[model samples]
Target: MSTFGELFRVTTYGESHCKGVGCIIDGCPPGLPLTEDDVQPQLSRRRPGQSALTTPRDEKDRVTIMSGIEFGTTLGTPIGMTVPNQDQRPHDYSETDLYPRPSHADWTYLKKYGVKASSGGGRASARETIGRVAAGAVAEKYLKIVAGVEIVAFVSSVGKVELPYLEALEDGQPIGKDFSNFLDHLTREQVDADVTRCPDPATSERMKERIMQAKEANDSVGGSVTCIIRNCPIGLGEPCFDKFEATLAHAMLSIPATKGFEIGSGFGGTKIPGHLHNDAFYRKADGSLGTVTNHSGGIQGGITNGEHIYFRVAFKPPATISQAQQTVTYDGESGTLAARGRHDPCVVPRAVPIVEAMAALVVMDQFLIQQSRQASATLLAPLHTPHHVLQAKPQPTV
Candidate 1:
């Protein structure tokens, strides 16, 4: 099932070495401004050959809009978008027609379909994600304008390195009157200077040294990504079938090479007692509810509590290692295989944007659900209140 969500659904199609890949978005609200231009930036972020650490497949990934829009506004119909594959080297995998790459989907795909596309893992390639990222950008724009929510994700860990919480690093920093500007000036290269995205100078250097060593050896490594979503409104999920966390996990795990996911305290919480792991609630000065500690990761009972949504996703190393390894052919003949291709030594750095894109997709779906249920005038009455209330008066001399 390529489609996801009951409302605001999206279905993706195409193969790795095919002429193009695309997605069809259904249930998008009518009159929302959308265009191919709005979706291009995010696709560029995930396209191959963007940097030294990604696959060297050079694809321009130019997107085209086939339908569902006119005059830059969506028509509440299915929106179809596609990106043509500019640089395709299908001949690279031609020699392995009968042999399957170890740890790849080639064997299973053949078994499931009786035949498989021979070019670059076909639909299983990370290239399929191009469509998802494109559609997700549209969802993100809608969420930002209509829901007032923000989602940000960065490479928190690569191999053994991990970044410290942003709040902790900002403490005791002496910035002269412009804290936001100070943060904005920090580049990814400066962050990478520490190795684990940790912001701790010493620790990051050690992590970078480790990565450099691995790169020299033609080896690869993997790590985790942390995503933080802020300003998510309360009550944005279904209870029984499609819980917020479950839907989120499904969306993330669907990404190629993602191995594991955990929210809040996650696996570590199991070792601690309930008293220690539970988030304590309190009333704020503004009379809104708040959690003293977000050990529950800003979600409780399958619903948002207006707190930051934090989660971590673990990714495995790239499978296309240069080292020769043992493998078998389609006919069960054993042989040795040495991977030959340009691939990432570590996928963590590039995965940061993918994580943010998936998070945006999940949040946008939830926000659409929220809008549908609260469209009634009575439910939206409180949202129109003024800071200073004025009493109602009788009309006179009209």
Candidate 2:
């Protein structure tokens, strides 16, 4: 769907190689500090050509606020923004009209709609995520100010190159910092310092080499982006069908080229026995409940448990490649088509911001829903109180 979320709604518009792309953010709480500056960072991060690993196509991707703010503060109306498309080479995709790139959305989109945009994958292009990234920046700001929530994502793996797993501390002495510390100290600077976006310098080098190798071979590589949401409050999700993780999976998979989503123990937990997989709870030094382990990934029963919400998103390699391959044209005639265009040899690096954006949207949406529920219940809290226990008589309005 073009619109996402129940309370903090966001509707994205425009397409790849189009005039511009952006989003309308509705339901943003009033008086939150907001501006083009807040949204531009994520857009810049998602933009192509900043590094050798991504596509050469470069558009400043600068955004302009069209509505819904006054004096650098949100007005709680539908916030409209747009970023004009520049440097679009529609001619590069001219051949795609006749022959859909293998594994690309060209064919499926053409089938769904009788007519399709001749240039780019239209909305299926990674460029479509610009709006999401923009709207997410707004949501992120709200979450940070209201809840002290921090969201960050990085390229966790590229092809076979993977960072070492977060194993338990030596002899259960808690060698590593706890989830709060990890989230507190994990800054975007550390991630952006390297081209691969992997926090570890060594692993980032290997990941960059892998992307360069794919570019040299006229091929592509797939990888995963891991995101962490810290300081999220408990009870920020619904039960049953609308579980937090389920909605989170839906958001992550909505991004172009995304193939998988995993939270907490995810698939690996299946191998471990229940005892090892379960996160044991205890009272913390602050007199608050805490979990000794985080196998649950900061969530249990699909709700945030005040722990760090950690997850990974797997993205397939960008489908458009320079390699020649035999494929059928739109008319079913056999042909060999070699795609030509500026495309990322690997998408995981650019996907880091998109992953973080989507995470922020989910968290913000859930937070708003929970807040509304709590507010309504609290408003009616004294309605059913026992008459004998009432301290003072209710005052009457004139």
lDDT of 2 at 334: 92
Error of 1 at 85 (Å): 1.0
Stretches off by above 4 angstroms in model 1 are 165-207, 376-398
Q: Which candidate tops TM-score?
A: 2
lDDT of each: 0.74, 0.85
Instruction: Encode model 1's per-residue lDDT on 1-398: one tens digit a residue.
Output: 78876788989999988989999999888888988788887777667776555677888889998989999999999999999988887877764686798878888899999989887777778888887887888888887777676676656567756654423323422212232232334443453443244445665566566566677788888877777777787888788767888889999999889999988666655655677556778978866678866767768888888777878899998777778888888888998877766677777666766787888888888878776766653465455447588533311100
The TM-score between candidate 2 and the true structure equals 0.92
Worst ten in a row by lDDT for model 1: 172-181
Candidate 2, residue 35: CA error in Å?
Answer: 1.2
Write the residue-wise lDDT of candidate 2 on 281-372 in tens digits. Answer: 89778666779778678888988887788888999988989999999999999999888788999999999999999999999898888878
